[model samples]
Target chain A: GAGVSQSPRYKVAKRGQDVALRCDPISGHVSLFWYQQALGQGPEFLTYFQNEAQLDKSGLPSDRFFAERPEGSVSTLKIQRTQQEDSAVYLCASSRGATGPEQYFGPGTRLTVT
Target chain B: SQQGEEDPQALSIQEGENATMNCSYKTSINNLQWYRQNSGRGLVHLILIRSNEREKHSGRLRVTLDTSKKSSSLLITASRAADTASYFCATDGRRGSNYQLIWGAGTKLIIKP
Candidate 1:
């Protein structure tokens, strides 16, 4: 079976620039999540989506961060005005059910803001 | 912030030895899960143990959950060089009608062949 996939495995953006990371979850996965992991640290939750609805965005750091899963399958995490502090690995994961304990992950997009 | 910590931040052992990692959390959880991540790669789900289950086994991986103490442990028996990686424990907590996983800092394991 196909696993979750993310685009732009590595991204380099200048400060003040905007970046968008894409995630393609496994076929028929209903729950999607986004996380940010700094170097040598665990992943920090960012947002979650149940189908096309954004269920939780409390973990989003600031207004500069936005996410959408318009079709309930593919998702995109956008960071506006990138900052050096925003440099980290952005991870995406999906589960079969809304509250499934097991989740499949994507390779993630490593964002570097210079 | 992380919910708890994984003890022995790092461990190094020879191949074919058993490796054990411990994790502790602060809140009640529905389940605890283990994940493995290799260098520059996504995490792979290793095992999941519900709060009600005391222990579980999958292949060479063994996971134990202690709800009373809010802790868990992952033990890998007869490990191989491929087992060298970071192992993380995630506990699921309530998030409105749903649930979200709270992750630990993870334990780095190094295996010498």
Candidate 2:
């Protein structure tokens, strides 16, 4: 892909419902990251992966948030029992490596929980 | 918790004027990077400065990092209306292989044409 791509640009879910967001990172990238951005705020780190390994999940707000990069190419962020506070934009980024390389970001999926 | 904090929550300027934003961090970092985001869009990387480097330049952007003060400044020369966007400063602590990037709230810049 020319750039990172996210699916279902927008999602509306009722409280307690589950929603899944997908990200297709740039081809051949080795590092993937997920972030959550609240209105009028900067993106907050959620999780990070080096290829298929989930190296860091410390930033996940709760156990309800789960992310997986099965093939190290595409990833998915699933939130269970969504709450109103979950309404925000979920962003995905990928870098060439796990080092201090530049990261390319996807447009993100805007999730609205009501 | 956020490691970086950007000053001047918002700034309004006319086109062609230069805009400056500052960021302060709490701990030591391996590198500091700047990013820009338009409304309802993802962030775009602007520049990255390593801890060993005092300053760096890219096109109309100039970034200065002071590890002693744990601060960094970004100067955009000759700003245009298109430059109106939110700017963020992120820090890479280089703890391990994960490379976590702590972000600041950001400074919103509005350039009037």
Candidate 3:
């Protein structure tokens, strides 16, 4: 792909429903990141992956949030028992290398929990 | 918790006027970056300034970093209507830390044509 790609550009789920968002990072990129952005707010870091290794999950807000990068190229963020406050834009980004390369972002999936 | 804080939650300016935004951080940083987002979509990287560098420029974008004060500023010269977007500042802090980068709440810039 030319750039990072995310699935389900928009999703509306009822409260307590579970939802999954996917991300396809740039070809061969070694770093992947997930962020959450609420309305009228900046994106907040959710998790990070270095290749297939999930090196950082410290940013995950709670047990309801889980992210996985099985092969290091594609990742998924799953939210269980979604709440009204869970409604936000989920963003995925990738970087060329793990150290300090610039990050390229996907359009993001806007999740609306009603 | 957010590591960076940007000033001026929103700004309205006329076309062709220069727009400036500032960001401040609490901890030491390896580098700081500025990004722009339009209509709440994906963000586009504008410029990055390393701790060792005091200033950098790209096209009409100018970025400055003052490590002593843990702050940075972004200046856009001759801004246009197309430049209207939400600007945010991010920081890459100490290594071995999961929070590689912390983002600010962003400043919304509205350019009246």
Whose TM-score is higher: candidate 2's or candidate 3's?
2
Tens digit of per-residue lDDT, candidate 3, span B1-113: 78889988998999999999999988887778899999746898888888899999999999999999988999988989999999999887446242367889999999999
Better of 1 and 3 by DockQ: 1
Which 10 residues in a row give candidate 2 chain A its minimum summed lDDT?
A97-106
> Which portions of model 3 miss their true places by more than 4 Å?
B94-99
Q: lDDT tens digits, residues A15-103, model 2? A: 99999999999999999999999988888999999999998899899999999999888999999999999999999999998664688
- CAPRI grade of model 3: medium
lDDT of 1 by residue, B27-109 (tens): 88778889999976689999989878999999999999888998999999999999999999988755423357778999999
**Residue B108: error of model 1 in Å?**
0.5
Who is ahead in lDDT, 1 or 3? 1
Q: Runs in model 2 with CA error above 4 Å?
A: B94-98
Q: Model-by-model lDDT, in order?
A: 0.91, 0.91, 0.88
Models sorted by DockQ, best on top: 1, 2, 3
> How are the candidates ranked when ordered by TM-score, highest leading?
1, 2, 3
